[model samples]
Target: MIPVKILTSEEAERLGLKKPTKKSGFGIKGVGCVVQGKHGGEGKLMEEIILRENGDLELVFMDPEREKELKSRRQFTGYLKQFTKIPEGLK
Candidate 1:
């Protein structure tokens, strides 16, 4: 019932989060924080689980921390003016 944001690499570093040896080769290792949640309950958590050759794996939430950084990458936004003309067939 709550909305949660992703984690950033910097926030994970300051929290003393380190790579887990036992879970190595499984995926990325780290935890993250969430901003807020529903009814003031526990917020969402973020963490890395595995890492692959192509850098694709599962990231899970283990614990939620407050005031942590958001996601690492920003969303892509195309230029509005450049999109003025639509394809003839599509319309």
Candidate 2:
């Protein structure tokens, strides 16, 4: 596998990551959010259906394109840490 260049905070800032003005806020960037699930009211059909090897169905990410911004898994985790109290199941 190719080594990925991890972006420094300064580098991320140069790429349009504005420093959070709020106290206790994160100081990083290059992150995006994706959401997918039932919508248009309860019991509505999901937008995308994914069949897993375990035979479970999962919804397609609504913002897959946005998720491509992260360079590595660590970056993705850090980004989520900024806004989420991650559950043990997800961790």
Candidate 3:
């Protein structure tokens, strides 16, 4: 399973990501996901996140070209912190 960075609303802003919404019914809002490739380049599956009250985080890892060329976006998401790290630029 691929790891995805989990940034708080403030952290996301520092990294130029979207902010969390105060009115969101979800417990976690205004979070951002960033996936970095092994070749020292950033991945393109950038998106903001909202964690439903009882939902979980998910992720997947694959070659970039394959990820893009793949016809469907049936991706898996998870909240593991192995492949992900708080980006140095944000820290």
Q: Relative to the true structure, how large is the alpha-carbon lDDT of every model?
A: 0.38, 0.44, 0.45
**Between candidates 2 and 3, which one is better according to lDDT?**
3
* Candidate with best lDDT: 3
Better of 1 and 2 by TM-score: 2
lDDT of 1 by residue, 1-91 (tens): 9797666877766676755445665343442233456785885443323334334443333232321233222211221122223233322
Q: Estimate each model's TM-score.
A: 0.19, 0.21, 0.22
Positional deviation of 87 in candidate 1, in angstroms? 37
lDDT of 3 by residue, 1-91 (tens): 9899888878888886664555355454334455445676766654333444435332333434533443255433222242233323222
Output the worst ten-in-a-row residue range by lDDT, candidate 3. 82-91
Q: After superposition, how far is residue 48 of candidate 2 from its true place, in Å?
A: 20
Q: Summarize candidate 2's per-residue lDDT along 9-73 as a digit string, tens digits.
A: 88987887766545333333233334444567444221233444433334333233334444344
| CA displacement after TM-score superposition, residue 62 of candidate 2 (Å) | 6.6
Residue 90 of candidate 3: its Cα lDDT? Answer: 24
What is the TM-score (0 to 1) of candidate 2? 0.21
Each prediction's total of clashing residue pairs, residues at least 3 apart in sequence or on different chains, is 6, 0, 6
Measure candidate 1: CA RMSD: 21.5
Error of 1 at 76 (Å): 15
